[model samples]
Target chain A: MKCEQISELLPDYLQGSLSPDQRRTVETHLEQCADCSEEVAIWQKLSLLPVEQPGPASRARFEAVLQAYQAGRSNQPAHNSQWRKRFSSWNVFHWLRSPLGAAAWSAALLAIGIFAGLRLAGPKPPSPDLAAMQSELANMKQLVVLSMLQQQSASARLEGVTWSTRDQQLDPRVLSALLHTLRYDPSVDVRLAALDALSRHSAQPQVRSSVVSALQEQQSPLVQVALIDQLVEWHDRDARPHLEKLRQSPNLNPAVRQRADRAISKLN
Target chain B: MTLAPDEDLMLQVRDGAGEMLGVLFDRYQTPLFNFYSKLTGDRTLSEDLVQEVFLRILKYRQSYRPGTPFRAWIYQIARNARVDHFRKFPRQTALEPEMLPPVVPSDSAQEQQEVELLRRALRMLPEDKREILLLCRFQELKYEEIAALLGCELNTVRTRIHRALQELRKSFHQLTKGTAS
Candidate 1:
């Protein structure tokens, strides 16, 4: 059997998942090729690395979450401000208490509200300018609401704005909110929006720094490309080394490379 | 009136239950975090993703079914989050299969070195293959469970796992040859 074919079956053979004939073929190759034999030995040893369990930080985070729950329940008086607050307070407390309970309540409420809202709000569409105004007003209100929500229940507040539209341009306050969301928002959608917004205004140093920070720490190659694209636009000579590092990254998606190459070309 | 265990909690949080959700987070955070860490190769991003996954769970808590294994449901959420993350930031370079790090020469001093090398090499593998190996070897998930989690056919899972291991083996061979030279 060719080395490549035998090589393909090595994992299955090791796992005893291969057919008897295939296994024999691979075994024959292994005996003949010291290189393949050594490869097998290394895999066997590499597999022995201890599978790490969740560290203390994870448990601590969970404990803190439980504390937050207890605090929310014992401090129920905090929810008296508005109808939204009242609903959120109750929802937070219930969610803290039981998953099944929360599901049932959410399912019922969503069924009523989402269905009713879709039905009622569907037909009477407002003018685009009015809609934009309304959305902007809501976003402005959400800024305060999101801040309060963050203090009270950061996770929930973040969730509420995960899919929120970007209407604030690069206003400092709005930028701050987007930055906070990029760093702490629980929704990838929100994070992506923050990235997108920052990319749009990549000329600012603060925006550039945040995007670069996210890029350095980001694992998602897609997000990395977004940051790279922005950096490319900025034409920051300081960014060339970082771009080079990305060029050498084996996991970098090819599409990202084409863009990176173009960016590097621009830098040069 | 004191809230009934389920009813009181349900009524109190009609919008959804904060405390009950904590239990769910406690149960699955580690596996999910580890999975994301492996997938993203960045600790900070993984942590962020984990928190985001929980946030999503909270946002959609009302949609959850009572008897479903919370792990499976959360995994589905995590998978969706990952897909969305990828969609937003598509990669520029073609991801090459990573080579394995050279093995430690059976000495005690070399053990730690070997382990570090192995970890780095593991990190280098294509994301899909690395994920499969991790699910099978580290998480010890059954093939069927993995197939369900990955949304692929059972045979596809088997093939991918086999291919990943083969690639790792090849990488290791290359590393050894390079070192010996």
Candidate 2:
């Protein structure tokens, strides 16, 4: 092969993309030519530069971008107004009022009513076993929802959250959101609600530990009371240390202190 | 509600869901920026190009099809932005390793200097060849993707990349010769 023809194929040769015949010719030429060999090595080096793994700053930039996206989404209308309009045209209420639709709606409400009544009547004191199971289900659901949310647009996910009644037992996604809010939510009421949803899972050692930690860390008396209530249901010896700490904590609200006192009595 | 998929997100943006554009921007900004940085050999220009690519993507979102590979589509935008940049300010010559500032030092100065020498030699090649080499050898893009993005045939992408590497190799040898002398 002429020098020019061989040179043109050097990139392919370096990348091992050259055909066997062309590769043989290049290999033969390189054996006789130091210049061509060195050229091939340089091309090899260019290909080897670590271009894929972005540096820390670039990762930070990416995170900032995601955060900005979240913030921007928050500023827009909370729901897809167009979707709401479309759904309105479908007149879900009108459909639900039809005989079959009314039957389904009544059946759903009756099921919910029965479940609520059973829960209220049978559990003046929450069952540790049921709470633990509910919490586990919630965590699993949250993971699935998070995975789904990542795949979908923020607005659609937010709309789903806003429209749907919070189901701590069945919807792990809602539980995840509640758990997240409990940890970082600015509103004491929301945090307390999150803690209540989280309490359903306190039979799990991790959930119990998290509740105790949140109780200790939280400055809000109401949230602390909610945590103490959760601890009372836990009946775990693991909760003893936190209950003791809450008992001695002078800054704690009297109601919270009273709850902690009762929880400590139960633990002992 | 489940989060919309990538195609759905793009469709939302295309249909005037302006806020959803941020999601696409968030998704791609880092990889695209890294690609631009390697391509331009300038961090500042790379950052600017990243923003420009997204802005253009937002402006032209209406043209995008939902079912397309979002990565390829976004990259096509980025590739066009880089081309437009080059047309506006043609470099006097390809950048030498010395012309570009050091990012991080390699193990030995000699080794580092050699790498720099290779980089500088690369900068000296014609723009089309430099880009093809960078995309294939540096960015690791497939010939087909490169062909699609560059509006060329797959064989042409391969051919150009091969030629670019040859040109870079020849330049490196000359540099080494001068150093030896």
Q: In order, what are the TM-scores of chain A for the candidates?
A: 0.38, 0.38
Q: Fraction of the real A/B interface contacts present in each candidate?
A: 0.20, 0.35
Q: Indicate the residue-level lDDT of B78 in model 2.
A: 83
Candidate DockQ values, in order, are 0.15, 0.16
Instruction: Work out how many backbone clashes candidate 2 has.
Output: 10
**RMSD over all Cα atoms, model 1:** 14.3
Q: Candidate 1's interface RMSD, please?
A: 5.7
Worst 10 contiguous positions by lDDT, candidate 2 chain B: B99-108
Interface RMSD of every candidate? 5.7, 10.0
Off by over 4 Å in 1: A1-43, A52-56, A63-268, B1-27, B86-108
- The segments of candidate 2 whose C-alpha lies over 4 angstroms from its true place after superposition are A1-39, A48-268, B1-31, B54-63, B84-109
| TM-scores of all predicted structures | 0.45, 0.45
